[model samples]
Target: MKTAKILKVATFFSWFACIGLTIKSGAILVTYLLSISNPEASKNMYESLNLFEYYNHSFLNYSIIVFYKIVLFSVEAYIAYLVIQLLKKLNIKQPFNIDVHSLMRKISFAIFYLWIIAIVHNTHIQIIGKKHNFELSLFSSDFVFLSLVIFIFAQIVKRGIEIQSENDLTI
Candidate 1:
């Protein structure tokens, strides 16, 4: 009963999170397009890019860094969507449903993908961000451990579904 109530809350919160993140993504898209045309748009976006500190900002360099930021935010929005799906699956009464296991697996995969994107993105940022004296967290061991745990939990969910199905057959 307690778990069900918690799942219900999580499902609704996930919906809210998904909507908010999608809106933020759309706003970033608008800003990115606008930044292409207006000179001031570049300045506005350069709020903290350290453009002049390390090297002069060329349109090409500014554009690449901006695009990378947008991609990173888009990944965050995608992860939110995956979380919503996982939460909704958990909201279902049947804890051993195959769909639940599938959602967990998808969530784990999304996390792994996000982890990879971060590493690759930060690598470029390090080469560039460091040149400008920008603060950067290039990698996270916390994420590494969490990703492994989530992936293992997904496998456990898969095993639970199989066991439930076998139990159903016997009855």
Candidate 2:
């Protein structure tokens, strides 16, 4: 009961954060596009985000950064949505249903995809850092382990669901 309450609260907060991030990203993107079209607004809007601090002159770099941001935020939002769905499943009477197992696998897959995207993004940043003479924090060991753990948990849930179904059918 307590855990369900906690999960409900967390889901709400995470949803709020995800929505805020989406709005923020959209605003920044709009500002960036406006900066490109209008000379007067360009100076403030372009410098507002400082996204192109490393390579201000290269349009390709700017586009890549914007694209990366969009992908990252979209992935994050999807993860949050998955969490909400997972929580909803957990709070239900039949939490061990096939839908719950499916949600677990979906979350795991989402995290895996996010990991792959992050690697590409980090590599791009590192390459830019190398050329521009800047340092990057790079990947965190904690994140790697967390993602693997989540994936393992998802597999466990899937296996549990299979066993549960089997038990239900047996006399």
Candidate 3:
């Protein structure tokens, strides 16, 4: 029972983390779009607010980054939904039937790997003109690491679900 509770808590945290990522990505997208649509206004606002002084790049790169983050966030959110469904199935005492949890686990792993690649690509672009050694922005690195951690936790929860299912079948 305690194990089940722990799994539930972990699942909740994973979902929360995914949602937080989505929100962060959405904010980035909005900022990028606003900057693109009104460069002067955006620049003035940035100057006044004293934010993003380091992002001295063209709108094209901003657009591309925003698009990438949106796609990644969407994928992560979908995976979270799948995890939630798997949890629901486990809660309702379903007939030990499908390998949905395993499938979701693999999908989550794949998405996390892709996210890491995207972060690397973005970081490469951000450091193009800078004289830094493989410069990675703090935000990008943090999100990548957070996604990896969430996926790892998802895999652990998946394994627990599989084991519990097997135990149920034996009884």
Candidate 4:
């Protein structure tokens, strides 16, 4: 009963996060388009994030960076959606189901992809900063560990499923 309650709470939070991130990504995309016409639109991006200097530096680089940022948030929103699905489908009594295992694997892969994009985006920022002689930083390479942890958990769930299958056969 407690586990079910906790799962419910977790699902709620996941849904909240999914909605927030989706909003953030959409806002960024809209701002990007608006900034194309009115440069003032670039002043405050997606809640006071000022990338105006980046825009001033090089339009191409700015576009690439903004694109990466949008993709990062979109991926995060997708991961949250996947987590909500996993939480909804999870049964505390018999938690090692194929659907749960698959969701975990997909979540891990999505996290890994997010980590890769973060690294690339941050690296791009660093390279551009160096070449252009301006300091700018973005993204952290922390999601890789998260991805690995979830991947290991997925594997453990897979093993549990196998064991449960064998036990049923023996029974």
Runs in model 2 deviating more than 4 A are 38-48, 91-93, 134-142
| lDDT per residue (tens digit) for residues 1-171 in model 3 | 786887699789768967876675666566666766555433333214212333445445544544655666666666666666666556434423355555555556756666675676566456652543323333244445655676676667667768877897999
Clash count per candidate: 0, 0, 0, 0
Please provide, for model 2 over 58-161, each residue's C-alpha lDDT reduced to its tens digit, 9 standing for 90 to 100: 66775676677667667778878887787777735555676777777787777777778778778887888778765452432234566678778777777877
Q: Per-residue CA lDDT of candidate 1, range 66-168, in tens?
A: 5666666666667677777777666355777777778777777777777777777677768866776665534342455667788899899889888988998
* TM-score-better candidate, 3 vs 4: 4
User: RMSD in angstroms, candidate 2?
Assistant: 3.2
How well does candidate 1 score on lDDT at residue 114? 70
Please list the residue runs of candidate 1 whose C-alpha ends up more than 4 Å from where it truly belongs after superposition.
Answer: 46-56, 91-93, 132-142
In angstroms, give how far residue 38 of model 4 lies from its true place.
1.0
User: In candidate 4, how many Å is residue 47 off?
Assistant: 2.2
Taken over the whole model, the C-alpha lDDT of each candidate is 0.65, 0.68, 0.57, 0.92
Error of 1 at 69 (Å): 2.5
Kindly provide the TM-score of model 2 when superposed on the true structure, using C-alpha atoms: 0.80
TM-scores for all predictions: 0.79, 0.80, 0.55, 0.96
Q: Which candidate is the best by TM-score?
A: 4
| Candidate 2: residue 151 Cα off by (Å) | 1.7
RMSD of 1: 3.2
